[model samples]
Target: MSKIVIGKYEGTIYPEKGGYTGALALGFGPDGKRRRLKRKGRTRSQVLDRLKAAVVDLETGVKSPANYNVGEAVEDWLAKGLRGLDDDTVVNYRSLAGKHVIPLIGKVRLKDLRADDVGEWLDGLAGSLSSRSLRLVHAILKRAIRQAQARDMVIRNVAELVKTPKGTAGRPSRALTLDQARAVLEAAQSSRLHAYVVVSLLTGIRTEEARAMQWDHVVAQADGEAGWRPVTADGFEHEKFAIYVWRSVRAHGDTKTEKSRRTLELPGQAAEALRRHHARQAAQRLRAGEEWRDHGLVFCSTTGRPLDAANVRRAFRLITRKAGIGESWSPRELRHSFVSIMSDSGVPIEAIADLCGHSSPAVTGEVYRHQLRPVITRGAEVADAVFGPGKSA
Candidate 1:
């Protein structure tokens, strides 16, 4: 950055346009090297106004050094900015900065950056990112730039002046039909994850919720006239099995949300699966002897260690492929399938929402709109009835 000077400097005055001549100010930088600052405007007054601001910046020492590059600033923030945050969050932020932000404009000097540079960088990412992912990338960049601005590293945050372009849509959530769900469950009967699959698909429990399950959470409700079945149902006197969704394997071993702590009655198949799985796990524990960890988790490996995501996913895919279901499905989609199945069976939306542990009916309705298609058809039906199909027109 150039120091403020007292005298006018020589510059070219263009004759083609009636405006302020392009001008310059001559001075010595902090390093004692000759420096020239340039400016132009639609009018001499406009040009002078900018020159005045530059002069103030130089006098007050607001101008940052031109040598500091974007890479240094972003790396500094990544190394020092994140404190007291979750380890997973730090890892994700670091990955995003390294993979997306640093490689592109890391070499550009902070003083040389412009709004257009930020815009072009984000626009180029549209080919590889989804709209949601682009927002995350933009947020990381904007936050890093803000950190620089707060410390007087840059005059302005160029990233804040740009908008992220909408990129590709994210993956569409899919649910299996009842037949496909049944097939997968049947195939899982031979796998170690049989109980986990049965609990998730039949009860609509979250994968995390299921992973955090303990044997103690499984309860047998005493048989009343309407054990778990409604008073009007034929099997009113049957015994009921339920699982208390009181915890998950989150950072603190808590459920995802307050409402997510629910108690759901399990179907007979899920109950039977758990019974068989408990016996199998006990046998494995004896065979492993002292190698068993004994976390008391309902789902575990052969040595009684708690199950991880990779374990469940591999087992899930294996059963899915065996059942002739597509190999692309995830365990979370079981909840979606549950919502769709209940919606198709004419269960009230609020009832389904309660079963799924959502905060409200609206939340369930919004997230599972694909499952609630039957309810939405009423609007079209009413419109058709009112207009008589537009035949009169």
Candidate 2:
């Protein structure tokens, strides 16, 4: 059952919800029949407010065509291709549309949306987001407009013609020095979870990739001539000991990149740590008996599902704190530390990039350049040796 009411200042052509829980629709048309606005409100007050606002805009001749409304356009665009995107990507797009774009410029006509309006929106978004995220937002809007053009709603996408605003510098990353890394590992000695920190710092694998590692990816021992080798194509041979990167878990997507699909030589310490980890994991599996899921992930929950990224981060914080380091550090910093330490050892940039799964040396250079400043200083020391120490010409 529902109640119907006409507003004092504006006439309503549709019924309002009677219950206090759900929303009601207050729609109007010139012919007095429902106009099919296709809009619903979350509350009676919201519906009334929508009606009042629409009336005011119409009276002032400021209302755009029903098809031109930005909110409606976003809804239409979403219906077209939302299924193709990942769950997390779709969630973020919906959030941006609802919280930022819709609240700010939803009333603007799709055809009327100018570069200035988009620019103003982006300007407002500055300082609140990272440069990377702002770029994503710009990309989302541009795609939305392209979707609109495909439907023949707008002649051109103003978002395409507009420049995206620059975003603020995100928090700077600080990698742990060798001493600090040792301290963290020492503190992690009591934790079964130390295996996570060990692999991250030692291998420089991305968090997601590390989360996806399995026991099958590693080869501990091999007989004469048939040295330890990773499983490749359902066959095992004495391949190089470093060729064990082939057997990653079957996640939804491919490995980060073709380049990321690489095998790296683990340090002796890392190899020993992984051996101990495997032993411990086997014991736990034996204890669990039939209760274990046996997903075979090197790092996983007791039930064998992927470990929650948030839980890993929280555990990392605890490990860092016990190591007498500040908790402000992030798990990604461990990867940075790996790159920094290797670069300091005069490892070639390409080699470091390959080990870290970077797409290219350029990508690694951009992110870890500050970490490699010592490399330049070392180069200077080399130059000083060649040129002879500190003497004015």
Candidate 3:
């Protein structure tokens, strides 16, 4: 063995088995303990090169082991980084990571991962995924790599350098026409989900918000200057009603946003349906007797348990089928229909935004762009009056 010096560190190169091995004593670490670096190669120069690389890795603070891989990093993040998120959200992230990220580049070593590798992975997924899904999966990888970087598991986030490629267009959201909306409302008249459909379609509240509604949140106009009282209040009767959109089925039972915590006056149809629903629920409570689990939610199963999205969806589809519309419709579309009906009635975008609990009209315009009528018919009418009707050339 011969002593070799590289920078301030001292090491020796010696023959081991069929290859040369280099061992270096790098000074004490922050823990006051000696740190050593070792490398093995077929030749002295190769061993020296590896030892130099190791020295650089130690200096740069990127000492991730050669075997630490992207899959491990993603799983680590899924385990730790997703804390405090909703259960459904955590499940969704894990599902996306398992399906798209792990299967594609999970085996790639974190140290060796490159921007080109990430870009190529995204390009490969472009054909199979929608643009939104592509962005979500890309964000998952970038965040996972970021988590690893914070732990010194990798030098940099390679996933951040790669641009998310465009993917296939997703299915565009659809709104029911006036005739269809009317038919759907009429069909819901006989179903148990009548009030659910009416409140969702007319009030533009999220399905989660609708399900989380409590009996206390539903208020009726009070006598004189008293304002309002809960519909469940003794001797309550009123022509006008309103609901406090103060909660949702999301984690912590919070609304989607601060602005989403609003109060909306109920339409005649919604208020009437809710009144009928309350009466029906009383009968249901009597029937269930001791079996009812009184959550006080405005909408619940016959057992008085809060209704889940699957319950709403299944019931909504049956109503849609009875309305002569296809069963492909979802409950979320009722909110879209609310925006559509409002826009078609020439309601201002700002007013519609407020009703939908949007932070701004821009959100309303962008999300429900297809349903909004932005063109001014007055200009055409004025032009027709000024220039008369011109013949086509």
Task: Please report, in order, the local distance difference test score of every candidate based on alpha carbons.
Answer: 0.74, 0.67, 0.85
Model 2 stretches astray by more than 4 angstroms: 1-99, 106-112, 227-243, 246-252, 279-294, 358-363, 373-393
**Model 1 lDDT tens row, 50-94:** 666555556656655546788788887887788765444677788
Q: Write the per-residue lDDT of candidate 2 for residues 1-393, one digit (tens) a residue.
A: 244443434233344474232222436668787543223466656665555545544444443454476667776766776775544467677877777777777778776688899898889888798887788777767877788777666666788888777789988988888778878877887886777787677777777677777766765335554455543322323322332454333335457677778766555455556667767777888887888897778788766666776678888888899999878878879888877776766667777777777788899899898886433222212222322223221
- Worst window of 10 by summed lDDT in candidate 1: 378-387
Ranking by lDDT: 3, 1, 2
lDDT preference between candidates 1 and 3, better one: 3
What candidate 1 gets wrong by more than 4 Å, as runs, is: 1-95, 110-112, 147-155, 222-238, 286-296, 301-307, 373-393
Looking at model 2, report the run of 10 residues with the lowest lDDT sum. 378-387
Using TM-score as the yardstick, the better of models 1 and 2 is 1
List, in order, the clash count of every candidate structure. 0, 0, 0
- Model 2 RMSD, rounded to 1 decimal: 10.6
Q: What TM-score against the true fold does each predicted structure earn?
A: 0.68, 0.66, 0.80
Clashing pairs in 1: none
Ranked candidates, highest TM-score first: 3, 1, 2
Return the lDDT, model 1, position 123: 90
- Clash count, predicted structure 1: 0
Residue pairs in clash, model 2 = none
